[model samples]
Target: MTQVPFGDMKAHYQQFKSDIDTAVSRVLASGHYILGPELDKFEKDFAKFVGVNYAVGCSCGTEAIYLALAAMGVGPGDEVITVAHTAVPTINAISMTGATPVFADIDPVTYVMDVNSAESKITEKTKAFVPVHLYGQMVNMEPLMKLSLKHRIPVMEDIAQATGSLFKGAMAGTIGEYGAFSFYPSKNLGAFGDGGMVVTNSKENYELLLKLRNMGQSQRYHHDIVGINSRLDEIQAAILGAQLPYVNQWNTRRREIAKRYNEGLKGLVTTPQEASYGAHVYHLYVIQTENRDEMQKYLSDKGIQCLIHYPIPGHLQKAYTFLGYKKGDLPVTEHAANHILSLPMYPELTNEQVDHVIAAIRDYCKEKNTASVATPMSAQVAGR
Candidate 1:
C-alpha cells in the first residue's frame, strides 16, 4: 500500500533545503533574533506581496488576529462576528481580545461564512467582522463590506488558510481593514515553525500594532500603553522570507492538483466548490460524503491519511458553553463539521500519489454501493 500523509513537511524541507539552511545560518550568525533587521525586511516584503502599506510580524496566527482586533479597540462589552465552522484558533483569537464572539452559519456550497447569517447576528455591540478565509478560499467580501460600512464595524480577515487567495482580483487580506496570516508548517507559504503577520493600509492601526506587538513601547524603557509581547522571531522571519518568492508557483500547483481531484471525485463525493468571486489556493482539499466517518476509517486502513478540518463547530464546543449556543444554532456549520473530510494536500504531492488516493476513494464508494448525494448547492456548483 502506498502511504499518503495529510501534509509532507519533510518533503517540503528537502525541496528547499539549501535555501532554508542558508536562511537559518544567516539568522544565527547575526545573533539578533527578535525584532531585528530580518523581521523588518520580511514585514516590508510581505506587505508588498499583499498590496498593503504596512505589515507587522507577530508570534502566531491567533496573536495576529488578536493584535489586529486590539488595535481596532475591540474589547469587553463588544461583539465580534465570525463563522463557527473554522479552526478554533479563529474564535480563540476573538476571545483573547476580551470580546464576545458571535456565531454565524456558513454557505452550503462554498462552506465559508454566510453573509446573510453574519448580518443577522450583528447588534449594537458588534464592533468587528472577521471573515475567515477557510480552506484557502476567500469569503464573499463585497456584501460583507457593505454591512461593515453601514454598521460602522471594522473588518479583519482571518487569512490563516488563505495566504495567497484572491477575491474579485483583490488579495484576500487587502480588502478588509486588517488581514491576519499564519505560517504554520503546512500553510501555502509556511515557515519551518510557528509564525504570523498582520497587514493593513491604515497608518494609525499599523503604528499601534507595532507598539502593541512589542509590549506597547514608544521607545526603549518607555511603556506607552498596556500591551502584550507577541513579536515574530527573526529565524522564522528569515525562513518565511526565503520561501516568499515561491508562493505563486506553489499556489498554482495546488490549483492544478485541485482540478485533478475535482475531475476524479466528481460524482463519488461533493468536492470543494470554487466560488466565482475568488481563486482557491487549496490549502486543504476537503470533500463531503454522507458516511464521512466510515470513509475516513476505510481510507486510513488503505494507507491514505485523512483528517477533519473541524469535527465540532466552535459555538457548540464545551469551552463556549457559557455563550449559550445550542447544537442547531448554526445549522450549516454543524452539518459541514460532521460531513467534511480533508485529504492529503500539499504542493509536493506527486501525480501517482494523488491518483492512488483518488482510486482509493472511488473504491470506497463502489464498496458501499452508494454514491454520495450532492446537495442542491453542490449540484449547482458542480454543474450537474
Candidate 2:
C-alpha cells in the first residue's frame, strides 16, 4: 500500500498545472506583479463568492487579521476576545494591534469559541469580538452577534481556516463585521505562497482596509494615513482566481470524508459535530480522543500521518505568560489542548487510506485494553 501523506499540495498543483502555468504566464506578460488588474478581479470575485461587498487581499492570513483589526481602530486600551484554542497567528494578530487578546473557552463539541465565555470576558475596553472559525466550523455566531450588539462591539471573524464554509444560510465571512481568510497552499483555495483577504459589507471599513494594506495610501505617492505595505501579489491573485471555482467541490469531498469517519469510528473515536447553521468546509477533520498520543504513534507506524491542531494552549505559551493565565485557567481549552488530533483530511484523500487510519486507531485501543488486563496479574504478584 502506498503511504498516505499528510498534505498533498503537489497533487492539487499537478491537477491544476495548466491553469497555474497560464496564470503565471499572464502575470509575467503583463509586467505588473503588484496590485493590478488581476488582483482587483480576484478580490471582487472572492467578495461575491463570500456574499460580501468587498474583499481585499493581503500578504498572508496573519496580516489579514491585523489589518482588519487595525482598520477597525482596535489598539492599546482596547480588548479583542477570541478562542485560545486556535493557531498562534490569531492571538498574534490581536497583540500586533497593541490590544490585549482576552481569551474565551471552546464549546466542547464544536471546538470553536464559546460565546458564553466571550460574554464574561467583555470589559469597557472591549472593542471587537474576533471569533475564530477554527477547523472550518463556525462559532455559534447568532449568540455572538447578540453579545456584540449588546456590548456594541464589532465581530471580526478569523476565518483563516474556513474558505467555503457557511454560517447559517449566509456565507462565513459575511456574518461578521469583517471576515479574514487565508490562501496558504494547504487551505481549500490556496495561493502559491502566503496570501490572505478580508471581506466585509461596509464599504467604509473596506476602503480603510484597502488603504491600510498599501501603506494607508488610496493612490500611489499619495499617502493619507499611517499604513503598511501588505498588498497581495498579482501573480498569487491570478493563481487563486483559477482555483476559486473548485473550492466548493473540494469542500464537499471533505464533508463526505468527515461523514465517513463519523460512521466508521462511531464507537472508538469522537468525531467533529456540525451545528445546525454551520456548513462546514472540514479544513481539518480533528477528533477529540483521550489517547491522542498513542493513536498518533499507532497511525505513524502504519505510514499514516496525523498531527495535533494545537499542542499548547495559547495561555501556556511563553509569549503570553504576562496575560496572568495559569495551567488550569480555562479548563475546557486546556483539557482539549491535550486530546485533539488532526487526521489526514483533504479532497484527494482516498477511501483505502481513510480505512487504514481507522483500523490503526481501533487496533491500538484493543491492544491497550489487553495490556491493562495483564497488568492486574503483575499487581497481584507484587502485593504477595
Candidate 3:
C-alpha cells in the first residue's frame, strides 16, 4: 500500500524556505516582536490586496471577528445572523461579544448562507449579519448586500477560508463593512502560526479596532474603554508578508486542482459547484455521497487520507442546545453534515496523486455498484 498524504505542509515550506527563513531572521534581529513594523507592513499589504482602505492585525481569526463586532458596538441583546454550516469560531466570536448567534440554513448547493432564510430570520434585534465565505467561495452577496441596506444593519464577512476569492470582481472580504480573515497554516494564505486581520473602508471603524485590540489605549497606558490583548505578533506577520507575494499563484494552482477533481469524480459522487458570480480557491474539494462513511473507510484502508470538513452542524451541536434547534430544523445543513467528505487538497498536490485518488474512488464505486446490481438482478431472474 502506497501512502498518499493529505495536506503537504512540508512541501509548501520547502517551496519558499529561503524567503521564509530570511523573514524570520529579520524579525528576530529587530527585537520588536509584538505589534511591530512587520505587522504594519503585512497589514498595509493585505489591506491593498483585499481592496480595503484599512486592515487591522490581531491574534487570530476568532479575535478578529470579536474585535470587529466590539468596534461596531455589537454587544448584549444583539442577534448576529450566520449559516449553521461553518467553523465554530464564527459563532464563538459572536458569543464572545455577549451576542446571540441566529443561524440560517445553508444553500443546498453552495453550502453558504441562504439569503432568503437569513432575511426571514432578521428582526429588530438583528445587529449584524456575518456572511461566511465557506470553502473558498463567496456567498450570494449581491442580494445579501441589498438586504443589509434595507435593514440598516452591518455586514461582517467571515472570510477565513477564502482569502483570494471574489464575488462579481470584488474581493470577498471587501464586499461588507468588515471582513475578517485567518492565516491558520492551512488557509490559502497561511502564516507560520495563528494570525488574523480585519479589513474595512471606514476610517472610524479602523481607528476603533486599533484601540480595541490594544487594551483600549490610544497611547501608552492611557487606557480608555475595556479591551483585550489581541495583537498579531511580528514573527507571524513577517512570515505572512514573505508568503503574500505568492498567494495568487498558489490560489491559481488550487483552482486547477479543483478543476481536475471535478472532472475526475463527476458522476460517481456529487462534486463541488462553482457559482457563476464568483471564483473558488478550493480550500477543500468536498464531495457528497450517500455512502460517505463506507467511502471514507475504504480510502483510509487503501492508504489515502481523507477527512470530513464538518460532521455536525453548529445548530445541532450540544453547545448550542440553548438555541432550541432540533435535528430537522436545518434540513440542508443537517443532511450535508452526514454526507460531505473532503479529499486531499493543497497547491502542493501533484497530478499523479490526484489521478491515484480518482482511480481508487472509481474502483471502490465500481465494485459496490457491481455487487449490489448483480445480486439483486440474479435473484429476480431466478424468481422469474
Best prediction by lDDT: 1
lDDT of 1 at 342: 94
Give the alpha carbon lDDT tens digit for every residue of 192-245 in model 1: 778899999999999999999989998988999898999999999999999999
**Root-mean-square deviation (CA) per prediction:** 2.1, 6.0, 5.8
Worst 10 residues of 2 by lDDT: 371-380
How good is model 3 by TM-score?
0.95
Work out the TM-score per prediction: 0.97, 0.95, 0.95
Residues 2-111 of candidate 2: C-alpha lDDT, one tens digit per residue:
57778998888888999999999999999999989999999999999998999999999999999999989999989899878999999999999999999988777777
Model 3: ten consecutive residues of lowest lDDT = 371-380
Report the candidate with higher lDDT, 1 versus 2.
Answer: 1
Q: How well does candidate 3 score on lDDT at residue 199?
A: 96
Span of ten consecutive residues with least summed lDDT in model 1: 375-384
Best by TM-score: 1
For 83-190, candidate 3 gives per-residue lDDT tens digits of: 889999999999999999999988877788889889989989999999999999999999999999999999999999999999999998888999999999999999
Cα deviation of 191 in candidate 3 (Å)? 1.0
